[model samples]
Target: MKLFYIKAALLNTMLLSFVDDGTILAQSKQLDDNNVGLYTYNPSLDLGYALHTGTSPLKPKTYWRYLGFYFDHRLTFHEHVRYYATKAFTTVQAIGASSIDCVVPIATYGYCLWYFNGARNKGAMNQLKWMQRKAALWIMGAFRTSPTGSLEALAGLIPVHLMLKKLATRAVYHVATLSDTHPLRSMMGEGLLKRAEPHARSAALMTPAMLGKVKSTVMEVDEHIHTLTESFKPFAPEARPGDRLLDRYADRLHFDKRNPPQDRHPYLDELIANARADPLTALAATNGSVPQSNQYQAASAAIIYKGHRELERTHYVSGRVTAPDAELNAITCAVHLAVKQANCQHIMVFTDSMGLAHKAVDPSVHSGQAFSLSVCRALQEWFEADDLRCITFIYVPSALRWDIHGEAHKYVTKLKVRVGRCKMDNSIDALRSQAAHSVLDSWSSTFQDPTYRGSEFLELQWPDGRPIQPSYLNGGPWLSTFRHSITEFTRVCQCITGHAPIGAYYHRFKINKPHSCTCGAAFQSHQHILFCCCDRYSVHYPHFLRDIALFMKYNPKAFGFNRDPSGVGSLLRVGLFLLLEDLSVN
Candidate 1:
């Protein structure tokens, strides 16, 4: 593919090729005539090639389909959007929980070409939005009248426009990872590819970068991602087998989760006693904390002990540090201290975050790679010093609050240090996380506004009683509960959307029928029925989701259209009379 790109660069015409099939784009009419019998395609007219065998010419299309994207002479891409939108909508209907995978990529295929390039995409976006709305409705079994925003929230679908923005932003990041000698690199100015100084203004905005009037993906990435000095690592496939950083050093590092602490102080005492028994063993506990009140105020602390006495303790407070960054920093501090200790053979590291422990040894190009690389280098020397010198990382769940680990955790949590005035540089991962969080905040805000999600949309809360925010993480909060049963899921959806066949809903639609409950309430409502209505319809206010599920199970026809209020009332009276008669007989 690189060879093809290089070859195409030498030519004057625009060549868009995918594998064996491709299209040659040109504005010259005579070029086609000049080729004559050599080439069968007519550039002057829409004429397809005729096979050499006794066969008719293939039908000429107004637009060409190349690389799964449709394009006409004018580059409208209207047919492409329409075709894929319909295809994705149909595919979404049959797809289960993974409908997002099927629809999003299909609908937004080649978006960088048309959408991110800043084309007049109102029509295209509308088509894509329609596709997404249908998919959301189907996924949640939501009524047609349900607000698109709420349905999308419950269905775990990002809005179409935002999804495009996210994809385009990620594509920009990908371009940053490309080789310096790549063709796209030449189009981007040198400033974008250069590593940013620790505390300097962004090169993207400070210098006149691109000659083009429109902003390219490289410029966009530069605006968001600050390039690090160690950003330009060789691509993964370029490395030879067993030559990768992780492959060579992974054996020296160990992650031990066995013999986990069942309780707090007792288990912690045993661990400390075991370490004290071995005079040559060094024990280290590290913790990192990023408080919710202020994400920028991150702190990492590590405590080390040799024999029966504390060897050293260190903690650093930094601004704009992510949880992983802080965690890796703590690990790095612990590793550095442990390796420096005299006569240390076996080192035991206890951390609340086991994932970050593994990352401390990872060689991937990610946030906190600098810290990880430092720890790996230190451990490499420590292990090479003596054959038996090894380290084990043990998982200590923060909830356990083991004595040593808890101390480190507490220090970081309550550490007070003046943050430097100089602005901190965020890693690519941090920037991406910030962007995702911003998108979620926007979604939550939109859902909260009655004008957007409609007043009737049910606001659910997490088990902790915090209001549930929209997220694709773990299949969203609402649908994951009743997703096992389609019928139950549909009923829940209807109730939340206020599109169920209840009395209030009927009255709102002007059905010209009674809207009162069996208990003679003026009007039936979600809150009224769930709390104030008769026994069958009543449940506690701010009820547990489990209770809601049980309520639906016990009163199967509570929210269904099968029985009206009068019918339910008659059934209740008849059941009461039967109970009385049975009691008299007994």
Candidate 2:
């Protein structure tokens, strides 16, 4: 087998070889015909050599394809974007609308390498945009003249530019969560010491000068990068497959779902009494709270006892945190106290939020890892001390106001510590929530504009009359409502876009058809059908999708021209009318 590994320090040349392909990048002080050199490797001699003596220099190409990415001499990536976009568009045309999802990723593959804001790459972006718009049109079955924004919104697709931005942002944040020893973290100019000493920075493989010369995605990461060395603790034993928290401790995690919160206090009190009566067991109750006045401020308190005698009471307050962070810390402190007990073999922890208790013992890389790691370390020691040593985590709802938990809850709630400003890092969950709110704000700004929504677009609202807002979460709010029924889903889309085959749409498009409703109302528009149509027994238009879905289910032919040949719709109406008449007669 032939093997190639070439590296030249003086000329600054490197080669990265994949299974079937390789990429070589070389640097020079100045570009000249005489200054070019060919880089070669000799496996037999274990040496790298620049063959410039009595040999013609290698010619530089205008573009090259490596590992499925096209690199242009000018770094424009125009050919790459055009190729994929055209390919996706063609594939979308050949496949059913449901398969549009398979083609979107094809057009945006490896986009992190080429996409950035204001790169003067509008041609490339336009190609991808046109491809997405094509798929959106097919998915929604909307006209070519329909507003691109409305069509993509109804199709549950983000705009091309915003999608690119979202992907780029997510990629940056993902790197931020990587372990300190990760190569990507090192390449992004961070170090292991950076988390401990926030001022410390690392010299990366790419120098500042080299970074400036390239259109790099790392440069676009901007302030999103952070040192998460403390968060990722892969060395913990709980992370192992057979020794995971649930694997070794599933039986210890107790939950009481059969009893209501009101009735749980008595059972919980009996368990506490049994624990305190045993000299070998310890009992603890923990509580955490986040004040509404200052969301970042959090407090946790725990009460530990043995043999019906109070042993330790621990409490702490932190800033720039979430409720989970506080709850996890409370569990951590309680376990730490329990582990220090002289001869205790069993420990019991009562928490209001069992979800947080499960999270505390979990060794996964998540929001409150700093607390979770501490909890895991302490519990591992406690569990390994003796075979009989075991812990039980019980659930006691805070609203139940059980004596033990209520005391801790009251203490944590009255914490007077206020943080005007601090340098503490926000928890991962808090940061993610903040970023989501920012993206929602951007969407609202664009969607609330009348011109952007188009003049004929039908606006929707919640039951309370607040204007409906768009979100990409959970398949967006609109699709999540009527996704179970194809007919109802299509009707809602048609209503929102005003692109149905109704009299108003036909008249506006100058199509040769009757522009009057069958009931003699002029222009069978959405407003007329929703409010004034006599055949449908017009009522106030619904503000919620649930109400809309029910209305469409009752009047199946309201939006479409199809009539039930079996007369199921007629039977449903007659049954409802007879029921109404019987109530009146009674």
Candidate 3:
């Protein structure tokens, strides 16, 4: 039994001696490469597994490495040689026969040194915990058996390993004065310090030049830590300094620069790396793409009302307003429209009407503060969200007719008419509301099937310039039809909106002027273009693509059309219609 225990101890010793302390990584070809991985920022265990595939859940298990029996790796091929000769000679004692000590000194010496080396390696401060496990196995073997020098040798490494482990705690590590760093920070956290090396203390005290790469990371981590926790107090005591540090960092609220109870997983740094690479900041830098300029009006979705009378015309305005005591009303009008329709009460209204939006919400932030041209330009922007929209004023560009105000000569009078006490048109807002209603109606268009489909009716033209009526979709020649739909849409707007022309960003076909329709007694705008001027009785003119998608899958990229579909009016209509349909159907 004594001989068997010594033999097992010898086997373990030999295994340990074969492994080089830092070079035992199963995944890495080069031991010195610090390219373990990008530092993960989240405190998770997966980061270690990322460095080496097939890492065992039972990690901290040691692999054997000897200086002589090396694994040689070429650029293309790798080779390893493991030396395992059964015995120097056939000996009964070595074969576990309680006969005699027949094994040679060289083999015995080699085996003893291997186990002793492992025991010593484990006892090092950086790996003291692991070393204890190693030392225990050998010491127990030595005592359980009569006497084995190998087991005795292992116990020798324990006291020193414990002392150095204690020494490691005494160092005052300065984090941010140096560079960007995450892994070192990870190590200071609890549970994930997988690195086991005798030289860990030396590595921690790197030269300034060496830290240049990582120093910035440490500072960044500090900034992030400070920012994340600004709203909340520190949850742990050692995690932060006294109330003074907390007070100083109160407003900043990021990473808390305090130690966790123990070293933790290094994978968290990986998450940080990924977050930094995202491009949202760059996107926000541009603000948002400028929306189409227009007199935005309407509420509960803008409406387009077309009179089936002669002299087709349309107008733009929000809901009816209670007469304001101050400033020309057109200036505050858009702001009022924006608040009620778009739900933007905190409107930054700018108009010649001294203080309109401000008074409507708060007079302090009103139209009077802005210049004249500022007001006109501000109101011209298309209706979007409140955060991205604004209202401006004009001294009523025209009443019933074009009236030039201010300095008589400042306006190059191409054609000027007189001002009158006429009722301002709120038709644009009405049309938008009607358009929303039309979409809702489409949802109810089909009861049995409940599947109402719309197609883009297009204007077709050949290379020789013969205008053609759009054919129903047959998988090809969509360009002519799409152009026709846009043309009809623009023309309908002219009929419904009174001479307002809608333009495209990029298209396969040129937009055609819409033929005037005898709808109402007012001018036309965007409200008339989509749902108003079209057949309001039969409801045949489908204004949105979700309608088209109902018939066939709508492809914004169909038929050589190469433009982002976001800004397209048709696409917006589709999304709105689809949502309405869903709500009604459900």
Candidate 4:
């Protein structure tokens, strides 16, 4: 009995060992499968082995779908593309069977292509283009419609290239932000300061020049980071009274009141009437009348005096209107003049130009415009003065109703008219002299006899009675379709530019021995390549005719092919494809 018990115990020990080994093996296999799905530099060798051996617990044929993106054991999206293609076709068929608009299916497929796979891989992009082409063809066939101009237009979708570019730009902007916890920041080793410190010890072992290069690199990285941070920093509201008033004016202009304001203000009509009745007297009266302290003025003054004493506030500025560059000069001049005339801490100058007003408020925008460097220098001088607390630019409506703005506008307009007259007189004199000599010799001159018509002696003339000129060589129907390979597209462009690699051009450059075609044509020019009905070129002849037919249907006058069939050869020479079916023949 004791011997029997010993044998049972031995069997039990072996059984327990087998169970533990199996469990460990299964857990390891699971780990390998999990690693295959991860976006790691190196995946598990065990997973690859399983894939090759076909012994993987998770089948090799099975695809793994995670986080909306699909992949197989090899991390390829081939199966994902196949699945979407089928889905798109079925959706389109269903939409066709129903009463839904045909545009719905196109839109649905486009949305799927963009959002479903996020266009994360080249395979996805290819699949998107293929599906779009198929969908467009299917829709046109179902609806009995002619082929649309371009692929995107036919599908009623944004171009795939543009969409991808937009997404890429957004990703780059996100990666460039200056957050420590950002994924890109971590990927780049937490930026220059941290990256440089770790390599400092290693730098001492290098040559002096190499060490200097390393130091310079570190400094460049630091400066780059600083620039990016400054560029992306959120703009704060300008503290000046002028900017605040401008913001208020902008808001009022875009206001959505229930009782909408009239298109024309009553005060404008009254001002117009006053001006018409007595121009000189009205102008004098308007200039003399001080603008009543309205809500805009009161609000501006209140904000300016918030931190200063009542006794310190002295000067009150209104507004001005002038030319584009003159406006900037006027603002600067007005601010200085106000400060000099009345010793004041704050001065506001309202202008009729939004562009100038924005430049004054935003330093970055100001720096990029023409003549900004000089303006900045002037501003720097004013800012340095201890008494000048702030110089601001506010926007005001350029209307005759506004008395101050009207007066400024009158003076500026008169000055501009005077300058314009002087420039115009000089320009007219110069243009008149050039015009006399610039007339073409072909142009009909009064010196020529009335009956000495040279064109009547010429043998060639347009059948439509329209005068044929050198300008016709440059005119043709605009090609609305460009869905061809780069090589073919380039050939089309060359043909249009009159520099195609035809027999004649190649012979001129010594690429070919003769400029003749095998059909015994004189010169294998663009006209011969398009119009020659030789046995070798007969296959493409129908396609050329079809293109011409389509061109005539849409644009008759553009090519004038209907008036003269001979001009069809010229039409074909100007970038229109000779063989529409076979793009490879280009």
- On TM-score, the leading prediction is 1
Error of 4 at 285 (Å): 23
State every prediction's TM-score relative to the real structure.
0.77, 0.73, 0.16, 0.30
The model with the greater TM-score, 2 or 4, is: 2
Model 4 has a clash total of: 0
Please list the residue runs of candidate 3 whose C-alpha ends up more than 4 Å from where it truly belongs after superposition.
Answer: 1-204, 215-219, 223-586
Across 155-263, the per-residue lDDT of candidate 1 in tens digits comes to 7787888877777766665565565555555445445544432222323334454334554444565555543333534344313456544576566567865665455
How well is each residue in 223-334 modelled by candidate 3, as lDDT tens digits?
2232111111112221233432223323321222224333322322332233235321010000001112222222111111111111111122222212232232333333
Question: If both were scored by lDDT, which would come out higher, candidate 1 or candidate 3?
Answer: 1
lDDT of every predicted structure (CA atoms): 0.65, 0.65, 0.27, 0.37
Comparing 1 with 2 on TM-score, the higher-scoring candidate is 1
Ranking by TM-score: 1, 2, 4, 3
Candidate 1 worst ten-residue window by lDDT: 577-586
Give each prediction's root-mean-square deviation over alpha carbons. 8.5, 8.7, 33.4, 20.0
- Residue 460 local lDDT, model 3: 23
lDDT of 2 by residue, 407-522 (tens): 78887877757776545556666655556667767777887776766666766654444566777665566665555654445555666676666688789899998888867887
Worst 10 residues of 3 by lDDT: 281-290
